[model samples]
Target: MTTTRPIQSGRRYRRIIYALIGVGIASLLGGMFLDYSLAGLVVYAVTAVGALALTLFLQFGSEIELQDEREREIGRRASDVTFQLFGYLGLVVFVAMFLLEATSQYTMTARAETLLYAYAVICLTWGGIYVVFRYRS
Candidate 1:
C-alpha cells in the first residue's frame, strides 16, 4: 500500500498505540484502586475488559493499512522493552517482598495488586511511546 512518505508506517499505527496506552492505564489504575482500598478479582476483570476494548477498537476503528512492516517492528521492540523492564523489576520486588516478609516476621504490605499496577504502568508507558512513534514515523 502507498504510504504518505517513503516509509512502511502510517497514522493508523498511532491509533493502535494510543489504544494500547489506554489499556495500560486502565489496567494499572483499575488494579490499584481495587486492591489498595478495595479487594477482589475485579481488578483482573477490568484489565481483561481493557484488553477486550483494545481488540474491539483495532478491529472496528483502526484502519488496517497502517500497520506495515516498520510499524510492526517498532511495536514489537516496544513491547519487548516493556516486558523486560516489567519482568526484571517485578522479580526483584517480589523477591524483596518475600525476603522482607520472612525476616521481619510481617506480611508484605504491597500485594499482588501493587505488582500488577507497576507492570501495567510499564505497559502503558511503552504503549504510549509506540503510539507517538507510530504517528511520527
Candidate 2:
C-alpha cells in the first residue's frame, strides 16, 4: 500500500504569489511599451490586485501556518540585517555627498537632499521601535 501526502498550503501560497508577480510585471511592461489607450489602467489594476492579494496573505498567513516558526525567525533576522545594511550604506553615501559638496563646487541635488532626509526619518523611526521593544522585553 502506498500513502500519499497532501500538498502544503505554503507551497500553494508561494505559487500564487509568484503568479501575481509575473502578471504584474508583464502588465507593467505592456503598459510602458504598448500603444493601447487602456494600458495604464490595466497596469494599475494589476498592481492593485497584487497588493490586495499580498495584504490578504499577510493577514492570514500566521493562522494558516504558511511559515514555520524557524522560517519566520529566519525571515525576521534577514529583514533586520537588510535594514541595518541599507541604513549604514545610506549613511555612507550621505556623508560622501556632504564631504564632496563641502570640499568642492559640487552641490547636492534636491532629490538627493530629500532622500537623505527620508533616510533620517526612517532611522529615527527604527530607533524608536527598538527602544519600545527593548523596554517591553
Candidate 2 has an lDDT of 0.77
Candidate 1 local lDDT, 43-108, one digit each (tens): 445555766675577558855454668768999899789888867887687777678777986575
Instruction: Look at candidate 2 and tell me the lDDT of residue 104.
Output: 89
How high is the lDDT of residue 32 in model 1? 77
- Backbone clashes for every candidate come to 1, 0
Candidate 1 at residue 7, lDDT?
28
lDDT of 1 at 25: 67
The lDDT for every candidate, in the order shown, is 0.65, 0.77
Model 2 misplaced stretches (Cα beyond 4 Å)? 1-7, 35-41, 50-54, 57-62
**TM-score, every prediction:** 0.42, 0.73
